[model samples]
Target chain A: MNLGVDLTFLEFLASLPALVEWNDFTVGLVAFAVKFAILVGGLLQLPPLLVWIERRVPALMQRRRGPNRVGFFKWRLYGLMQSLADTIKLIFKEEVVPDGAHKVFYHLAPVFCVFPAFLVACAIPYGPDLLVFGHKIPLSVVRLDVGFLFILAISSLAVYGVSLAGWASNNKYSLMGSLRASAQMISYEIPLGMSLIPIVLIYGTLDLGKIVEAQTSLIHWGVFAAPFSFMIFLICMFAETNRAPFDLAEAEGELVAGFHTEYNSAKFAAFFLGEYVSMFVLSCLAATVFFGGWQVPFVPYETIVALAGSPNIAALAGIMMLLLKASFFMWVYIWVRWTLPRFRYDQLMSLGWKFMLPIGLANVVGTAVVLAVLRFK
Target chain B: MNPYIPVIIVLIFGVLLGSILSGLAAFLGPKKYLKEKMDPYECGVPKVTSGSEKMSVKFYLTAILFILFDIETVFLYLWARTFDQLGWLGVVEVAMFVLVLVVGYIYVLKRGALEWD
Candidate 1:
């Protein structure tokens, strides 16, 4: 018996540019595919790594060994492989659909939870535009004119997942958890939006890439220009992600597993992945907006080009720098998560409305006043 | 090459990934349906009432407040983006808009709409 495999598809993929009309648009499509792969692939890979980091950091903080058993024979690397093991276990575990549950919605909630996380990543520029085959291509998957607003609007839809999951479970705790989660998200979202108003005021653009490009020098970063708004935005980021000390939705002491009480196996894993993805996206946004995204502090573009000997190398270095900053913020998330206790529901609500709202409002007015003064001068 | 193409692609990817994972679990995992196991959890005791019962009105109040403030913030974003072009007039307009919201906010606080207890 002779078996022959067809290699035509592989050949066709290699010959795509030649087979199709080689124009700017077609070349752009190819470039976009590569950029999309890099962005999505990079983001998808992060959740597992974040899971590992989250576990290890808390263990180190608490003086207990985290997951020291999963790696290859005797070289555990402090349980770095635990996330992998957990993924496998979750995938193989039993998935239960509670009797009398809303069948369609029960399945739909996890999808809703996970989708927005990926969608938000599309707008974030991972690095400066790269020159590919003499053509300039943006590092972001999508560079919308209103990149910031797109991110905010899409990320807000994430609340639907928790609310729907809680309601569909037909469980009291889940319902309460969803209610708290939705309420907290909506409440904090005001400050989140308001805090960014000052950044837009200073940057004068809603496009995140343009905002980053404006911060060519270290002093031009939004953090230094508007420290108050940065502080408020950082606080809101924590609350928006359902992280400590604002993670009342999943406060195990009171609400069991909260909105995810009924989820099992992969569905449960989906929510877990979504949370980590959201954390990463928020960190990236913070780095891009408040900090100089992909900008090596004090290093000019010409300096980077001279040091790297090529623009592509410089762009890669910029990408690494951006990732470094974003990762630091992600580490902060874990650090805060392990250190702080969850807030009481009453305290949480009051903090969002009474304290944060007023401060955010005042910050906006202050920013406006300062900007107006500068313009007149 | 539309700017939104990547967003649509990412969205489709997310939906597919989510569906595949959930479907895989449903297909691969063991099926054991027990009446006790399927019931909505309430510690170890029987649930007092259905989970779908009416919740507190405070949630509604919070939602209303959110819509009001969130819309104001959106307006702020628009004004902020174009603040330079609009100059002092824009700042004054936004200030007036915010003053109106502050009044509403104070009224919300006085009514105890935000108080959980």
Candidate 2:
């Protein structure tokens, strides 16, 4: 209740609703609103652009001209407007909640898919901070002290959406596909959680902002510090996101669109959007943890600020840097989708359990030993 | 200025956005349902079996094992965060914990419980 004293994260969490100071509360609310508008708003829009890239990149890779027809007036816009056209068509398309489907859950499934995706996306710090009128503003929509753990916890909730969609459709394929999807998600989740432990160990911090601060030195970036962990994390990211090679649950040739075999119109599009948004969010996390979230490589935050003569510009550059790194991974996601063959179902499960899980566990112990020895030295 | 307020705000916004996206087509798009069209996609043929039939038990096995390993993984996070302060003792403790996890994992592997067939 003491307003003058500093409070821990838990204290802040427990002390909510009893919070006084009307002016500060209003200011913070406005700040959050603006951050949401800029960050989460962009996340909502990013799927369409990613869809364009998904189409165009594969076309380029396969030496084929992709949707170049849809354009503004004459600009062609590199087929950018194609996604816009598709989004409109998707919205206007008739929705079918097939007979024998559970009406309530069928409608609710996409909401489950989208809600967690947005929450996790909003938690990711886009850049360092913007300094205005000598006031500091963190770039992310919501900054949880346990940001890394929070992301892990919330993302696990996304599986329900897929599972529900699979089950609610009241089809044999839907039931099997949902079961496979949920099982795959939970199975891969072990390795994903294991893979990330080394990041917390190496940085000795749970707050992603602090993790980025720890990695300000290029040599200390997460990928270098725990390259093995990054490799495991990379594999798990694919499995967790249900991306290609690990996309056994929704194997179109096998499962007939998998868990989403029944959803139509924007409901179907919701699952698609959720998948891409999570992909982007995970890529951003990887970039932040492995590549230094907002830190310019070799050039530290202070250096950027000093060179630009404004912290705001430095932050902007850092945001672009993080986005660039994340987009590269995004491109990799698309590239792999087109390039790699899907894994057999058994192979996917075995990889998670027999391989990545043990390696991830060992990496944690190995990292701890090294860190402890280094400290003693 | 509690930091948790944004969590609520984000939740509300997400729910609104999700519902709008999911519900938009219902009002905007025309709907004309037929008996055949309402049936599930079974390669354009009649159903051979009831939907929601029992699936392979392998998924259930995986889920149970995941619950065990996932709980263990989360426990490590606490040790990982304060690892610098805990130092060598923390390393030893986590190693022992993971050692148990590895042995259990080996048992699961040996049991052939994860085999899909």
Candidate 3:
């Protein structure tokens, strides 16, 4: 079939696959591929583990045995394999594409959920630079200039997943649930955005790495610098991520599994994975921005290097520190999930819009006023 | 050394991963289609109506409010980035700017635009 025009363009397109060289750019691309794989692979492992935690923690709270029977042939790895077993079962379960559902978007929705979680993972500073084979590689994937905003931009796209899931399912419960979920996410986003302003104002940079460096001391941390900002951020983080106390989107009592009611098999699993990854993503952000990204409190960065005996080891320490801090927030996520009851739709909206938004705005203004006065004086 | 190369790669990776997982499930999972099974869940009752209807206006209102506040934040981000250089003059100007917006915010509140019921 002879198509119209541009034979040479097609030739270039065909030859594009053959383009390869061991240049710096290609080397960098290879490095990025490895890093991306490691980061995403690691995150892929997290959901099932988090699923385990989510189950076990709630069971512990409720004083029940929560999957303690999923042992390996009398070994009983203490119910650790339960999520894995559930995952395998889910993968093999009957795939159900409900009648009248939008085929394209029904499948596409979970992609929207998982993509942002992985993309924003690139921006988070895992640690200081590591002397990887003496090349001084930074322990992050992408080094975009608009770091934090890039995170907000991408992570906010997660709403598209839940909203799309609800719409495409062609179910009453799903549609209403999606409507509520999308609105709830958007409502909390105002305070989420407002809270970030104080961090940017205090640090005067969009780069997470720079912010981490600036918070060298405990008192200098963002939580102390803008306590209200941190509070607002923490509140919105729970609401926006759709965790309990704010998980009106998937309120099982009212919505019947809410957005994912129609999903089954791997598509359902994808939503589960996406939710856990997003929780981890937001927890990492809270730790990085407010609690000091990778800083070891009371000990200087140079002191850490000296104590650890190498820059590489020190970088590992930083990574550990970041994970430690982020995991604390993750614990809070689970704790809050089990502790607080779901917010009423009206209560959730009013909290995000009326209560949190105004306070977040005031916090930003207060932070600016104080910073201006202190610097000028 | 395009930063976007990695981002683009990750995006493509995401698409491929999602499609692959869904396809695997489609291939691996058991298939038995019945009319009742295919129908949307309605608590074990026969289907009475289609799934969609008119939604609350408050959702759109919240969205409009979000757009306004989100734009304000973009400007706030720019100001925050150059906050130190802007000094007292910047503070006063931004304060006045926010004050003007606060009247609108108050109007939004008093008019009960944020009310859920």
Ranking by lDDT: 1, 3, 2
**Model 1 CA lDDT for position A369:** 98
lDDT of candidates 1 onward, in order: 0.88, 0.86, 0.86
Residue range B1-117, candidate 2, lDDT tens digits = 667778888889898999999899999999998988889888899878877888888877888898898899889998888887786777888788888877888888898987765
lDDT of 1 by residue, A156-189 (tens): 9999998999999999999999999999999999
Can you give the lDDT of residue A210 in candidate 1? 95
> Model 3: what is its DockQ?
0.67
Per-residue error (Å), model 2, residue A44: 2.2
- Tens digits of lDDT, candidate 2, A316-371: 99889999999989988998999999988888777778888778888888888887
Chain B TM (all candidates): 0.92, 0.93, 0.89
**Interface root-mean-square deviation for each candidate?**
1.2, 1.1, 1.3
Error of 1 at A278 (Å): 0.5
Worst 10 residues of 1 chain A by lDDT: A1-10
lDDT of 3 at A73: 94
Among these predictions, the greatest DockQ belongs to: 1
